[model samples]
Every structure is written in C-alpha cells, then in structure tokens.
Target: MAFRRDPKTPAMTTDLPQHVFRLRVRYDECDPMGLVHHSNYLRYFEIGRTEFLRSSGGRYREVEEAGLYVVVVHIDCRYRASARYDDEIDIVTRIAKITAAKIIHEYEIRRGDEVLVQATVTLAVIDKTGRLQRVPEALLT
Candidate 1:
C-alpha cells in the first residue's frame, strides 16, 4: 500500500512517489543474538526500491533490454532499533531526488511505527557498456 502523506514529516511531502513494502523477517536474517544482521537492512532497502520502481511501470527487465541499468553508487544505512525473526516489517521508500542521470532513494525500515533503520541509496543510470546515461523519463513521472 502507499501512504498519502505525512504532514508532520518534512520528508513526506506531496511531490515524490512514496512506496511502502512489507515483509516478514525470516529466521536466517537474524544473528546468534536474534537481532537482524546489519547487512540485511541493505537487502530490505533494495526490495523496497525495486517494488517502488515496479509501481512506476519501470520493469528491470525492460530497462535492461533497453540497455540501461540502475547501478548503485552510494548507500548509507543508519540503525536505530533492532529487528528480530518473525517480525512483520515495513520498508518505506521514496524518491528523494532525481537528476538527469541518477536517482536517489530514501528508505525507512520499521516494525510498526518504530523505525529500525534509515537509509539513503544513490544509483546511476548506466548503459550496457557501463557508461552513465540519462534516467528514463517514465521513471520520474
């Protein structure tokens, strides 16, 4: 489901496409102490971004077939709380910024209203030859 907007959060203004993706934490996602492994948060953010792209009619296969790919340029995840196995989590994703050749996505991993992780990922639109290219116009709308 998609969130209408969060009036209180400056980040949730009406301009960008905000997508919410939900998932259940699997047993393998946790560590010996039972908290989700730090690296898995990156994976969750990826899932959130991919789903967001899908809703915008941006199919990865179609993009690749057109000889374009979204390749990660930067990622930063900040841990705030712990996530445990079997927990139902939500990954809130939004387009933080879009330029001629790149897109930036912001993500929040939460268990209910409690945020477990916050992340920002930057990706470049690259061609099959690995050279930067302009982001597709369809993705911005």
Candidate 2:
C-alpha cells in the first residue's frame, strides 16, 4: 500500500501517491458528550474517498453512467482516539490494492497530529446485473 505523510514531503512526492482531504467536525455530527458518533466516522470516510476520486478525475455518477457500480465489499475501522465537535480533521486515503474487479482503500482520520481512526475499505465493481467486472482503465488512469 502506498503511504504518504504529507503532499510536499519528499517521501510522499517519490514513494507514495495518495489523496488527503480536510473536514470539520460539525456539532450536529457529535453525540451529547461532544465526541463524533461512531457511525458518522464511516460517513466521513466515504466523503473523503469520494473527494479523492473526484480529484483523480472521476466521480461516482460518471462511473455508474459507464455501466460500472462500485459496491463496498468490506470495511474495517479502529478508533484510537476521539474527535470532538468543531475539530478540524484530515482524512487521508490511499489505494491499498487493485485487482481485476476490486480495489482496496485505506484511510486515516486525524485530528491535528493525533490519529483518531484507521480504516480499510474494499470495493468491487459490478454491472447492473450484479456480475463482477474489471475496473475501467479510464478510471485508473
């Protein structure tokens, strides 16, 4: 898996190719204790991945229009810390692996210098009829 610290770091520029997106924890997304709800972290990860794809020159709708649909096949997350409301978070995502019909993405949710969550998600491309299909070359490049 490609892992980059920051976009400008030499290791990031030469060794890894990943996307990073920033988000703010909203008051409405938190529980009464002021910590972000567990479920909402998944939503945040999704948004981060979507934005990563967008920056890579593709969008979910466009992929669907091309007869391809990505379905989440697996998701694993570990919460290491807590993020309170109004915290500025960084969602870092990278392509962990790619196969004929599947892609794996790894994510890290950080509040400043502290990592709050780490997740790995796997998605498979399928046709409308539910037959597995290879990811489009256009999408990869």
Candidate 3:
C-alpha cells in the first residue's frame, strides 16, 4: 500500500500497510504507580516500527550494511489511558507517508478495544557520516 499526503488536509490518505505487534506489559516497564512508564512508550514504538519494517521484507541491519541508517527525527505521542503490568497490548503501526528522505509512521497502542496511546513518528535516512540521504528503494517499495 502506498500513502500520499492529502493536499487539502494535513493528513496522509491511502490504504496504508499496517503491522500489529502484541506484547504483554512487563513489570520493569511500569513505574511506582504501576502504570507503564512514559518513556517505555518510545521503546514500544521502536520495536513496533522495527517489526513492521521486517515484516515488509526490510531489515535495519541490511540498511546499515548498505551504509545507511534510519533515525527518528521527530515523534509525537499522546497517552489516552494507562496500561498496567501484565496487560496484553497490541501496537498497530501504519505507514503514513514516505518521501525521498523521510518516512512517517502512525501508531496506536491498544488494550482490547480501548486505545491507550497514539503516536506519529518521522524517520530520516542518513549516512554513516550523519549526512541526510534518500530512503532506500527497498524500504520504500
């Protein structure tokens, strides 16, 4: 599935590809309040994105081997509810947009039918020397 920016609105529109990753909240991921730590959400997003790419036939190791690295340039996450340890959650990752130099992803972390979090992440491709580069063709397709 290909995603394109809806010119009129500031949103991407298309039948975007999505990958769902399920995980149980770990005890260590929770804070004293028994809720998952805020920072852990970022790690969850990272894992979801990595698996999403791999499921699509791309690997971060392969990209790095080609002297390219994908880095998170920006991220926006909104916490809608709290997740406690031992809860089974599903992180749904979707490709929102893919440009020459960047790829944007949208995510939803849900417990059953309830959404716990929503996030958008922008990733940029760079060379070993930290110079901007176009996203690899293998990843875009």
Compare candidates 1 and 3 on TM-score and give the better one.
3
Error (Å) of candidate 2 at residue 109 is 0.1
lDDT (10s digit) by residue, model 3, range 27-98: 999999889999999999999999998887778998899999999999999999999999999999998877
Candidate 3 or 2, higher TM-score? 3
Q: Write the per-residue lDDT of candidate 2 for residues 16-84, one digit (tens) a residue.
A: 358889999999999999999999988988898898888978788988989889999999999999989
Query: Residue 54, candidate 2: how far off, in angstroms?
Result: 1.0
The TM-score-based order of candidates, best leading, equals: 3, 1, 2
Per-model TM values vs. the true structure? 0.87, 0.86, 0.90
lDDT of 2: 0.83
User: Where is the poorest 10-residue window by lDDT in model 2?
Assistant: 7-16
Candidate 1 least-lDDT 10 residues: 5-14
Residue 108 lDDT (model 3): 96
Q: Candidate 3: how large is its RMSD?
A: 3.0
Candidate 3's TM-score: 0.90
Q: Is candidate 1 or candidate 2 better by lDDT?
A: 1
lDDT of candidate 1 over 1-141, digit per residue (tens)? 332335554222235568999999999999999899999998898899889889877777887888888899999888999999999999999887666777788999999999989989998999878899987755555
Instruction: Report every candidate's CA lDDT.
Output: 0.83, 0.83, 0.89
